[model samples]
Target: MIALPFAKSGSQSFLRGDRVHLRAPVGGDYKAWAALRAESRAFLTPWEPLWNEDDLERGAFRLRIRRYQEEAQSGTGYPFFVFRNSDSRLLGGITLGNIRRGVAQCGQIGYWCGVPFAGQGYMTEAIGLVIPFAFEQLRLHRLEAACIPHNKRSTRLLEKAGFQREGLLRSYLKINGLWQDHLLYSLIENDRRSTTNNKGAR
Candidate 1:
């Protein structure tokens, strides 16, 4: 596993495009991240796993900090917060998790966007940057993403980022306290190469 401190050092680094920026989460960001969740509870709850009432408590921020730190250290995950470059507003977050180094050579993608920022293509850009990092920096061979079938937005984002629809998974995830069906998507290294080649051809 990569050293945690080494990973944490990357939090200060960022990826930038004309409209979006992706960077590691900072301690000061807890307030904003938590507030977005608090305000978007209703908009997001139905699509998310059960959240403890205490999940947003001020003191709980420490736990999140620790979790992020551990994730960085172990290389099991890299969590990033998305921002709009124009105004530096936090739009949402995406994570590359469950990273396995050996034969698996894969990781899963997960994300959430604030209700107000739902349709601006920020998440898609974030995923685009992260997937390359997963493949190039992390040396992962494949990446997987799953979304509730009802989440057409997420499905679209995955597709736009070059993931192929793999299939449906029944009772695959627990959302808002209920086991639900999900659609899986994946991208292999070859798929990325093909995409780049196709873009060049066009």
Candidate 2:
């Protein structure tokens, strides 16, 4: 098992990396969360599903928190909000969703970084933190991620985090306002172990 060196909580599962920490979203985060999303609207909207009219409102955030809590309580998914460690500023969010257990033992990884935080490696560190959480804490066999084929930044971040490109998913998800193709990538437990071993051997 991989040892998580930084920090982790018992139930809340707050993850801490060298530069960032992730905790489940709560009602109190509404203001800062809304502000970041509003500022990064143009950078994020194109890659995300169409947002509701009141998506940034407090009521909507509360509803979203409820949904996330339900998903976690049901053991179907886990969501975390990424924050900068230095000043505790909100940077973005990441989630391990659509979890499948039994024979599959897999889950999908999804995330978004605010425009100002993009290209600064915060998302990469966030994903690095989640990998162990998925493979060790959750005991998931595989983790999958998908991004639009032309999204170079997303592709780079995934590759940097050790995800291997699998295939193109034709019209796999509805992004913004239209269905679009996506590139699928995955990192399995054995693969992660092998990578770790190789790095250690070198």
Candidate 3:
């Protein structure tokens, strides 16, 4: 991917953590993004919805970028590409979608890591960065995530990042071309704050 551009004032638009940074995807990211996803197809397919044959094509990617930009601009959702801070390598992606305002200030969080990057702490760190962005910048009250019961890695990642397992949903989503059950998890703003406070009190 091309180097991310900065504003003339030099403020960073991307969310930065110790090991990774989250940035909006650009047109140039198509190549690297496609390659990474293609390489990790088997690893990711099971947890994700079935992919169309043209899913990795540039046209489809461009459409994705456009939709993400629109969503971000409209405060409906925020999409980010996860990159390693040391080398700026694209590792995966995370998104806060289905944002609801007014009476319900909540959004759904989803993420994936490349096969090669799996088992590392990259995804956990990425979630840490996104939570602050969702709760602080977006002023959201709660973030929800769901994972297949069999996806132990994802379940562990969510739990490690402080999400509470709420329950299980039967045939909750269509993943890998079939309806699958998911374990629901959520992190509320007050819960997060309490956790932080408790840690600081230690």
The candidate that wins on lDDT is 2
- Please give the TM-score that candidate 1 achieves against the real structure: 0.92
lDDT of 1 by residue, 1-202 (tens): 6542322422544667678887777767778889898888898888899998789876687787778778888889988788888887888888888888888999999999999988888788888888888888888999999999988888888888999998999999889999999999999998998989999998
Q: Work out the TM-score per prediction.
A: 0.92, 0.94, 0.94
* Model 2 vs. true fold: TM: 0.94
lDDT accuracy of residue 110 in candidate 3: 95
Off by over 4 Å in 1: 2-12
lDDT of 2 by residue, 14-133 (tens): 888999989888777889999999999999999999999999989999899888888887778888889998988999999999999889999999999999999999999999999998
* lDDT of each candidate versus the true structure: 0.83, 0.90, 0.89
Model 3 gets an lDDT of 0.89
**Residue-pair clashes per candidate:** 1, 0, 0
lDDT for residue 3 in candidate 3, whole number 0-100: 26
Which segments of model 2 are wrong by more than 4 Å? Answer: 1-13
Using lDDT as the measure, name the better of candidate 2 and candidate 3: 2
Tens digits of per-residue lDDT for model 3, 42-130: 99998999999999999999899888877877778888889898988999999988899989999999999999999999999999999
In candidate 2, how many clashes are counted? Answer: 0
